[model samples]
Target: MPDAENTLLLVDDRPDNLFVLRMVLAEYLPDCRLITANSAEEGLTLAGRQRFDGALIDMQMSRMDGIEMCRRLKQEAGTAIIPVILMTAHHAPADLRARGLEAGADDFIERPIDNVELVARIRTMLRIKHAEDRLRAGNSELERQVAKQTAMFREYWKAVENSRDPFAIIDRGHRYSLVNDAWLKLYAIERTEVLGRPVAEVHGDEYFDAQIRLSLDSCLTGESVQYEQSFSRNGERPQQLQARLMPIAGEGGGIDGVVITLRDVTREREIERMKDEFISIAAHELNTPLAVIQGYAELLRDEPWTAPYKRTQRQEFLSLILEKCARLQKIVDDLLDLSRVDSGWMLVLHKSRWRVRDELDRQVWQFQRETLKHRFEVACDLSCGEVSADRGKIGQVIENLLGNAVKYSPRGGLIRVQAEVEGNVLRVTVADQGIGMTPEQAGRAFEKFYRADTLDTAIGGLGLGLAISRSIIEAHGGWIWLESEVGKGTRAHFTLPLMPAGTEVAIPNEMSDLKIAGEEKP
Candidate 1:
């Protein structure tokens, strides 16, 4: 009896022969299932309909012989692998046996068949067929696994290539095994020039020896290492880069290589520096006014009523206290405005018709009273008219510009204020012959917490003035900028669109429609 279930096909022209063959197979191999066909045509049809592990066919038939049937089965893709045994008559010709083998028969059997010999041949053929089937299945599974792994590798490479940060995979020999698109772009090199090349050769021996080699060695020793480095390319500004090195484990569970990733952190570092500077400056600015106010208030409190000129002294002390309080209020207001801007809150406008010349005159007159060293020149075209805008915000912007001009110019010179109506826009200019800024400083003058003057300079106030002024002007659908040259002078200019008469003003909530322009240099 067979160990596994088997299906076999039997074909003969005579019914008695088929009956005898079936009885013998059923008696010897009870585990096998046998299907009989009376003719070769019937056998071929049965083979087409289902699968058979092996087939036994009578060599002599009425129309189609066993040899011809065997050839046809071998020719078909579906039945080609089914082992065929041809049953020949006793004392069959040698040429006939040769022809049977040529027609793709697996083995032969004699007509005066010994029952045991017949059974043995069929069992052998079935076992071979079963082995071939298992091998074929194994090959198919291997192919599937290979295809799946290939797809996974492709997806991994695609993700690495599309990343913005630079990534590289180095082999155990310290040679470049893989580099993503960003890595190539960072070095401005080609893929062919990088792969299989030594790290020291590509990144320069000094750089590799000083910074990368030790870190890579540590990573290959199964330790993840991270470090920061600065690099300058093509005479450009140096970039602060943070590098992370991770160990790549091999099949044997040992560290094989290192995966390197680099991220640029220049802007983040600069922002941290600015934040630290702003905190220090804010503390000093707020402390100065508080000290002055405290001193004056104490003086007024301790003064005697009987002392001569006590009334005059008390009035002067009160005025000094009031002035310091005003200074404290301005600093608080500027800080509050900055918070509002950063939080994406709109600077609300109280829109009313107000003359540009009148606002300019008021700001100039106020500044002139505070300083006698600088002279003012005012020029306004008669055509310059009233604009619908927030009066307090506009006046604040004018004060900031005038204040900057006076503070920057220690050696006072002529300050000029001009106003004109250009088509539908009201243009205002404030030019000062003070110590100005370089092109780089002027360009970033409007940036929050950015000041041209260093901490050592005698200048005061937070750098929020220009930034807040820009926001206020932009909220009214206006543009503001500065033009300056180092050691010469600076000119500040701004334009506001004139609202048509009888038009309703719609204030924005997000300031999304504001058209803010960049700074300029002359």
Candidate 2:
């Protein structure tokens, strides 16, 4: 590590001067390797080819003087740091010494060289060179290590940028140190747009500062956090994102940076909305009948009337109790239907086909008797059409749709039920002049237990009606939907394949006097 262990370039046009200097160096600094050059040009060549700790130059060389050679070496980067010692035979004038100093010589020694003076000056120069050499070696090693670490960092950053999930890293200063391809793709921006920018510059200042402050505080304390956020880009509706921020640590548990991952959760949140609606509807339906039963029971115990009229009062109470009990039983049935659909228990057990026209007629007759408040119109022109579906499920679908129509419609409004055949598909429609919903509400009508109207209507039924109807129709390899406009009317329409390919069709019904008016056979 000492300068003496390094190569020393000795330049002198006179062989005697080179020999004298080499001998002095050999005696005092035996470890130093000497590279001899008879001229300044040769010394420059040697300096470029080999590493030199120091250079010894003769100030009075013939072709090129030591001052000019030192200047040239300093101009060239390869030998610029090497220390130069200028030797002159003529006790150089102060102005010449000044010129030598200006030319970048580190030390000057006058020659015909007094041995003690020559040795003393060279020893001093060698000491300085030794220190510089050691420093340079240490610095070179440090720079090499830094270069290796930088390469590794670049490779890791590239891998993260190529990942599918949106990923980024932020320093304590809240500036983006890294951002990935997926992050840019999701935000519809280039990765360059975000890197090295403050968080506020990329995301809006308000949003970015709030979220970053929270994440930074948590991460600084060695904690991880996750939350949801909404962001709007351009003029589009805001998008939902689920974000997780984790702390990256360095040696001694110091906070280094934060790694953040973001995922789109809009669709998942919508599904949760549907689930919550289902729960609300189910709870309301259960509470309704229970409330009715409780009211009647309390009236029977608390209200007082003449003992002579006790018989009639008891009869009336019993009738009210039976009605509420029936409503409760119907709610329980809906729950069971939902369970069956979810558990796949209903589909595996059995399957059957029934006369389509007969089933339609039967549902209409039953609904007519049960809900006399609504006008029921049935038009089944296809008297012999048979549908290949599970008899129970098909009946449930028809019953649910019809029941919803009757329950939600105004008293004595038109409730049109029609069945017809078009090519290989059988179409059934239930149209009602009732409280219709907006397009947005209609889109979510079949979602489990959703109601656009207020809960105060006291409809006395679970919101599972349309959900169950659609499930059954879909299970039968059919498609069901509704067409509606607010305040005008709503119509539930479904289509079933004629005979399910190779299956035989059963007779529809035997009913005649079929005055099926105001309905067209498709």
Candidate of highest lDDT: 1
lDDT per residue, candidate 2, 156-177, as tens digits? 8888778777898998777888
Minimal lDDT window, size 10, model 1: 513-522
The residue-by-residue lDDT of candidate 1 on 375-480, one tens digit each, is 9888999988688888898899999999998988879999999988887888888899888888778877888777676656658888899988888877777778
Q: What do the candidate models score in CA lDDT, each in turn?
A: 0.86, 0.77
Estimate the overall C-alpha local distance difference test score of candidate 1.
Answer: 0.86
Tell me each candidate's TM-score. 0.79, 0.58
Instruction: Give the Å shift of residue 35 in candidate 2.
Output: 38
Instruction: State each model's C-alpha RMSD to the native.
Output: 4.8, 11.4
Off by over 4 Å in 1: 1-21, 33-141, 304-310, 344-357, 372-389, 409-436, 473-522
lDDT for residue 137 in candidate 1, whole number 0-100: 91
